[model samples]
Target: MSIKPAIFLPELLRHLFKRPVTVKYPFEKEPVPKDFRGNVVFDPPKCIGCMICVNDCPAEAIEIIRVSETEKKFKMLLHNDRCIHCAQCVDSCPTKAYHMDSEYEIAAFSRRHLKIEYK
Candidate 1:
């Protein structure tokens, strides 16, 4: 009896003869895409501390603490663990204070380090 050949045989052979598709990490750093949503950054000066970002964030990853009402500047804090990269805060900012940066390699064993305060 004769058996049918695999349809992926040609593709498999082509890949086998070709070079490796992946590069070694740590040794070689790849460039991130322009629109890649790696992390969020907040500009303290641009932000009026109106709490729009804190209130609009879907993941509730942002916090605005009122250090002093007389000072008129609140501390903008971010919890990376709670952030889902939804970009809601970026879109909700009235003064374009928050922006998404291309830096997704934030691996860590501790969750405390993920929390950042932009002052």
Candidate 2:
């Protein structure tokens, strides 16, 4: 069958007079939802070296390291480049050390800039 441009004409006309539904992003931003998962926020002090966040990440983007072997202090590294932002780390963390951030503007010039280490 041949394509018809007229089929879309009525739908286009109906929306033409109405105010634009598109947002003026960058200039203005819509508020994120209360439970929106944007990025990983790690609190070093709250972490108990459980390594559950590291093990449970589906993307394998997170790493937990021992900062001090004698003191059991741990450090966490979040590879945002590989992160899917599923908030699995937040859910898996028993100590509430990991939480999702609200900021969605996660763009970076380089991949290296996306890697975040928490100590």
Candidate 3:
């Protein structure tokens, strides 16, 4: 098969002068849009330990732990790896303890590090 240099020459010349379209993702982060579901944020003080979030979560990422006999001292553990970011847990919370944050940069090397604890 014969190689066509004429067809490739124009594309190569155009790319040489044109500026790159890709943004520096690691250095420059684009702003997250409104109503963007990134990650789960749990407020320990506002949480009533109702277990509503735990039941509503489709991913089963939310786990409620009993700190003592008192309901006020309950703790919550959220596994980010298992979470699908569907915002189901946030909607189910009556106290508005669970919320979705704008920050989406959640890359991690280990699964253990992705787990968030709320007390």
**How many pairs of residues collide in each model?**
0, 0, 0
Q: What residue pairs are clashing in model 3?
A: none
lDDT tens per residue, model 2, 56-94: 899999989888978878888889999999998888888
Clashing pairs in 2: none
Question: Would you give me the overall lDDT of model 2?
Answer: 0.89
State each model's CA lDDT, in order.
0.85, 0.89, 0.88
Comparison by lDDT, 2 against 3, better one: 2
TM-score ranking from best candidate downward: 2, 1, 3
lDDT of 3 by residue, 1-119 (tens): 88699979999999999999998998999888999999898888787778888888899999988787855776789999999999998888999888899988898999999999988
TM-score of each: 0.79, 0.80, 0.78
Better of 1 and 3 by TM-score: 1
State the displacement of the C-alpha of residue 52, model 1, in Å, after optimal TM-score superposition: 1.6
Worst 10 residues of 2 by lDDT: 46-55
- The total of clashing pairs for model 2 equals 0
